[model samples]
Target: MQRVKAVICYDGTHFSGWQVQPGKRTVQQEMERALTRIHKGEHTPVVSSGRTDSSVHALGQVIHFDTTLAVPEDRWPKALNQLLAPDVQVMETSFVDSSFHARFDAVEKTYRYRVHLTKERDIFRRHYVYFYPYPVRVEDMKQAAPYLTGTHDFSSFCSSRTDVTDMVRTVHEITVEEDGDELHFTFRGSGFLYNMVRIMAGTLLEVGKGLRRPEDMPAVVEAKNRESAGNTAPGHALYLVEVRYE
Candidate 1:
C-alpha cells in the first residue's frame, strides 16, 4: 500500500462539513466515494487535517489515504476531480512517507473570518462574507486583539459543546485588516477548539460595536466561562486558510 497526501479546496456552501455523516453530503464523503468507485466498490478510508463546521470553506485543507492501486500522483487530482462535486476540488496530490499523518503532524493552523460592512450588500461577497452594515470601532478591536494573543485557557471563546477538557491553546497572532467596507480577521495558532475562531470574531465585533471594552479582554479570558464571551459568529464567514506541518 502507498500513502497519498492531497491538498483540497472546497466551497462549503453545499457541504454538511468535511467529515462523513450518514445521509449527508460532505467533502470527505465525496472524496471517499470517488475512491470507492476507483477501487471497484470497496470503501476507502480518508483522514483530514481537521474538521471544519458547516458552511466553513477551506483554501488549503490537507488529507491522506492509503491505497494499493498504483496510480500516478499527478493523475490523482484529475481522477478525483472528475468524480467530485463542483464545489469540492482536489488541487494536488503526492505520495508521502508512511509515517506522515495529516492531523497529528500538523504544527500550526491559520483561519480567517471575513466581514463586509456595507448598507447595500455586495452580491458577489454575500455568499462568502458576513454582512454587518453598522459602524465598527476598528481601533478598539485592534486593541482587544493583543489581550487574546499568547497562551491561555480559551474556554470563554470555545463552544460549550466541545468535548475536550483541555481548553488551553497558544495564539501566535491575530491580525485585523480592513479594505474599505471589508474587514478580514486572521488567526494563526497552534490549535483551536470547536467554534473558537468564530467566537473570537464575535467578541472582537462586540468590542468594535462598543458593547465590550478592550480592557475587558483579560477579564474575559480569566473568567473561563462560555457565558462570559460574546456570541458565536456565523460559520459561513470563516475559512480554513492553511495548515502547516513540520
Candidate 2:
C-alpha cells in the first residue's frame, strides 16, 4: 500500500459539507465513491485538512489517503477527475510519506471571505458573494483587524457549536482589502475554530458600520463568551484558500 496526497477544489453549494453523513451528499462521500470504484468496490477512506460547512467553497483543500492501487502519482488527478463530478475536482496529487497526515500535519491555513458592496444581488455571484449594501467605512474595519491578530483564546470568536475546548490559536494576520465594489477579508492563522473566521468577519463589519468601535475588540476578546461576538457571516462567502504544511 502507498499513501497519496491531493489538493482539491469544490463548489460547496450542493454539498452538505466535507464529511460523510447518512442520507446526505458530501465531498468525502463523492471522493471515496470514486476511489472505491477504482479499487473494485473496496472502501477507500480519505482524510481532509479540515471541514468546510455547507455552502462554503474551497480553492485548495487538501486530502490524504492510503490505497493498494498502483496508480502513478502524476496520473491520480486525471484518474480521479474522470470519475468525480464536475463540481469537485482533484487539482493535483503527490506521493506522501506514510507518516504524513493531511490534518494533523497542517501548520497554517488561509481563508478568504468575499463581500460585495452592493444592495442588489447579481445572478452570477449570488452563491459565492455576500451582498452588503450598507454603508461601511473601510478604514474603521482596517483599524479593528489588528485587534484580532496574535495568539489569544478566541472563545468569543468561535461558534458555540464548536466542540473544541482549547480556544487559544495564533492568528498570524488579518487583512481587509478593497477592490472596486467588493471587500476581501483574508485571514491567515495557525488554525481556526469552527465559525471563528465568520464571526470575526461579522464583528469587523460592525466596526465598519459604526455599530462598534475598533477599540472594543480588546474587550470582546477578553469576554471569552460566544455572545460577545457578532453574527456569523453566511458560509457562501467563505472559501478555504489554502493549507500549509511543514
- For this target, which candidate reaches the highest lDDT against the unseen true structure? 2
Which tens-of-lDDT digit does each residue in 41-69 have in candidate 2? 99999999999998899999999999988
| Residue pairs whose backbone atoms clash in candidate 2 | none
Every model: Cα RMSD to truth: 1.1, 0.7
In candidate 1, stretches whose alpha carbon ends up further than 4 angstroms from where it belongs are none
Task: Judge candidate 2 at residue 175 and give its lDDT.
Answer: 99
Sliding window of 10 residues with minimal summed lDDT for model 2? 157-166
At residue 207, candidate 2 shows an lDDT of: 94
lDDT value, residue 60 of candidate 2: 98
Model 1 lDDT, full chain set = 0.92
By TM-score, how accurate is candidate 1?
A: 0.97
| Per-residue lDDT of candidate 1, residues 21-68 (tens digit) | 899999889889899998889899999999998899999999999998
The Cα local distance difference test for each model comes to 0.92, 0.95
TM-scores for all predictions: 0.97, 0.99
Best by TM-score: 2
